[model samples]
Target: MSRTYVKVIPTVALLLIAGFSVSAWLVYSTSLGTDYSKYTFPLWTIPEGSHMYTQLRVGDLNGDGLDDVVVTGDYSLEAVFQNRTGGFENRTQILPSGSWDGFVLEDLNGDGSLDICALNATHDGTYLVTLSNSGTGAFAVASQYLLGPIRHVFPYRSHGSDVPDVGVYLLGDHNHIVLLHNNGSGHLTPDVYLSLTARNILDVLAADLDGDNQDEIITVQDNGNLTVWSKSASSRQFSNVSRYLDTVQAKRSAWLVIADMNGDGIQDVGLASNIGASRGVLVFLSGDSINVEQPIIERYYDYTWLGALASDLDSDTDTDIVLCTQQTVLVMENSQSGQIGGEIKFTGFITPHSPSVIALAGHPSPALIVLAEHRGWYDLNLIDLVVFWREERGILP
Candidate 1:
């Protein structure tokens, strides 16, 4: 063949191959949902004293524009600051040794800085310790309120106010709920309190489930009972109550999360339970009425799930679930019709606890943070921070 003909043939073949490669990639990107490309081996390990880390959260604590991690454990409150190199090597202690269970970050004093409300539940009594952050991001103990026998405290905001109200869920003999109003002074006082007959309360969360301006308090209890309370017409307290039973065979609710699972505007409920034969994951689709007979999406697995978090892992508009089971970590994608779609699994994580989605310091997209018992190269079984993110949105230095 002539030289000109050979060169022309090679050029045409190259053009066709390039065009096909681009087409293939487009199809794969559209079809491939929930692609968690890489997983880091334990970002931070718990030492001897701090054994079990219960809660983990990431935020711009120092106002450096880069997100930092804050964790709570048995009598421990630590912060992992992200440095200039995008590495979390600079560790600091936020609060002195105390039995800190969980905390919420909010601007309690209206200083535009996120303050910390660390809840301490001890045998003496339960207390809400408010840590006010100065303009320079240094937090000092501002005030403390004695909330008797409350197991969990969550932030509840209503009427579009910048100030957040605190929701306290009382367990044991109290068996009640209280809404603590923040009066722009870092002091939380009981504004409204209600007594409930529901026993064995596992978790309590607040959200506007009916798209109403008012928020509803949802409580997951034993014997497959899910009770919701709405603010009364007087707006003084939560008096209107509705109860749902046998929700996905979830007798004993382990963990609960409230988010819009589907693209629908209403927020749905997610539950994880390891009670007896009912060990599985369940999602309650919120409609005009969330009754006991409401539709539910459930999946039963061999291993018990520790917790589940909702995030749009595939860039799909709808939310998906990331479950941390004792056996492994599973990512369940959402379908176009708002059902559970594909499954993505990650192994080798022992006793994985909480799975959270946070925007890391260097990553553009949100990353998944899981706390798991890792037997690392040192051969020590310690709770480690397992981080994972999508490959396309690479982690920057």
Candidate 2:
């Protein structure tokens, strides 16, 4: 070969190598350009055996800037765990007798101080709504409301089965809901019981479903029915605005949550159905009447009985769904495009019976608070509050 020909061949080889190098560099840059910082994981599990039946985070619970947790357990025992330097310290305990079903923390009395609403089920099959607050590390009950006798009050009895058994170990019973309203006198009014029908009501939540300023009540019946009751603007009375039955042919109990899933300003409903085959339904409301139009149904593999469902995961502006099965937890994203995304599996964790999960929005980024019973205990065992974010380019900062 001639010298010029050899030089031309070498030049071509260099050009080919340069082209490949540039292509690889471009591909690597594009791959690293993604914003995975939003998926980072930072978890803080509450002290073991706190028996946190319900957990709510509210700011200035002890006149401090940090958010404090209000937890409730059996025997109407309500405790306020103050958010100290890094961990929680028991602050106060209130009303230790009737077993509690659900709880809420708010300034119900409009007193600038935070108060609590406890839904207590008495031993003799009666329901009591207790309102209390913490003063100098002790609880002081302000008022009590005797919510009429709950229809099926026995524990562990099937829905609509009035067995009338008084065994404390029985767990399947209809629990009453507790809703708090402030009387604006530094004292919370009695909890208003909102039971539409005599059927077993599973979960109840309060949110502004419509664009109205007042908050509405969203209840999920054990028979897989979603009911939205709007609070009257003037009278403060609850009126049944709309109801939606599971279009799917299945009899199931549902755990429901209300949030703006589609970022449409209006709150949408997320229902986790424990039907024959476990599945979840996301219903988006349109207009101001709780008119649910878009229904997205997602069925999980295996016997995935969904216990608790929460939204706003991944902090993507659009809401996501977290489903707690007996063994694993699945996180489903709401793409807002009418199509559901794949799942983020959280394994190696036990979701106790009646597990409750909520997104903690009080932090810089959102975290998840999961309330579950211990491996052997019947009461609440562990409170795992985890904050997650994503990192890109192998750097979290």
Candidate 3:
């Protein structure tokens, strides 16, 4: 089968600057100073032709301190790489045949061991791939469930929108969100199927939107609607909690992330819309309720494309926005005054067609930002960890 290549670019450099600002705030106290001189390692490229798409997640599947990398490819194969002292070692390849689109790594079975949930392109379905952290990283196919049905599938093409349609060949259809639950006993099951009104569903994120301990589902539809769904404790089923926001005009592509953008205890939703005149918005909620007081932040960027992940790049309490434009990755800092701070652009960095993923430690320290680029052959690029001290201080050196 011929595989399609997508170039994953890092969002604008505003995220890097945000990381520096946060680090400076933590160390310097008053002045904003960063140390970019320290060099840990040079930029290196991983093996090529991995057909990697989307952001790569780093976690220790074997209980080792070193993080293990999990990535989905254009084909059905999902690769697991072990992070060694110098580079990454291919540990195992699990699935062999369908196109894998989206993936999440979590202890779904509640077993303390991390497993993977992967979305298949061929059938608009999801599969649970279980990894036994036993000695050598052995993997097993747990379960597979169809999310629902896709209205239309489109081929992978760059129609000026930052959102890439994995391998969908058509357009104009309703996509379903597939949530997988580990059923223990070495099995996985589909927990929720979310239907949306938009032509396409760009991304689905899980977060504690309300005070409830369970994570709520937040999906960004192609029609620019941010739909929030919560699971019932008794039924273990998902229902639409509320339509958080539908302020923006319908756009083909957008990225969604859940973060406390305003330093409030509640998590806020940040939508990075990659329309022709690229612009982003931050919607802060009082709680899990759809009552949004101020949805839009004052400062907006023109032609700023949204990156793969919308996260708290800077350690600031608010979630920062990352945009990868034609040239430069911009990182915007969160401001209480409703205005975003200055942007930090990283020159000389090439973004793959896939989105960049951020690796955060449970404690305070610099986190690794993984960018998988397409270099003729499939190769994974490891960008320098844009360090941050506090969530508010911004990106550090």
Q: After superposition, which runs of candidate 3 have C-alpha atoms over 4 Å from their true positions?
A: 1-20, 23-55, 76-86, 122-136, 146-181, 191-199, 235-239, 244-247, 277-289, 296-299, 304-319, 335-342, 345-348, 351-366, 376-397
Query: What local lDDT score does residue 235 receive in model 3, on the 0 to 100 scale?
Result: 57
Q: Give the worst 10-residue stretch by lDDT in candidate 2.
A: 1-10
What is model 2's C-alpha RMSD?
A: 15.2
Tens digit per residue, CA lDDT, model 2, 326-350: 4445555666654445434333233
- For 1-397, candidate 1 gives per-residue lDDT tens digits of 0011000011111111121111100100001121321223234444564545367766677887766677776666777665554345556678857677778877787877778898876687888888888855577898888888778788877765668888888878888888888886778888888788877888887877877666788888766677778874358767655666753444544666665755667777766666565256454545445664554465556555566666665565566667665445555566634556554433433321322221111122244343433433343434455444343333333
What C-alpha lDDT, on a 0 to 100 scale, does residue 41 get in candidate 2? 19
Candidate 2 overall lDDT versus native: 0.44
Clashing pairs in 1: none
- Model 3 Cα lDDT, one tens digit per residue, 1-397: 1112223344423223334454422211111122332223232233344444444565667665545556555564444443433244554566666666555555544455666655566654433334443334456666554543432221111123222112211223435554433334435444445554554667665666665555666666766677776765555456777775555566656665555555556766666665445454333443445545346342344544536345554455555655555444555565644345554534324333323332222211234344443322222343222222333422333
TM-scores of the models, in the given order?
0.78, 0.62, 0.65
Ranking by lDDT: 1, 3, 2
Stretches > 4 Å off in candidate 2: 1-60, 76-85, 123-131, 134-137, 150-181, 186-198, 235-239, 277-303, 309-311, 315-317, 339-342, 351-365, 376-397
RMSD (Å) per prediction: 11.5, 15.2, 10.7
Question: Best by lDDT, which number?
Answer: 1
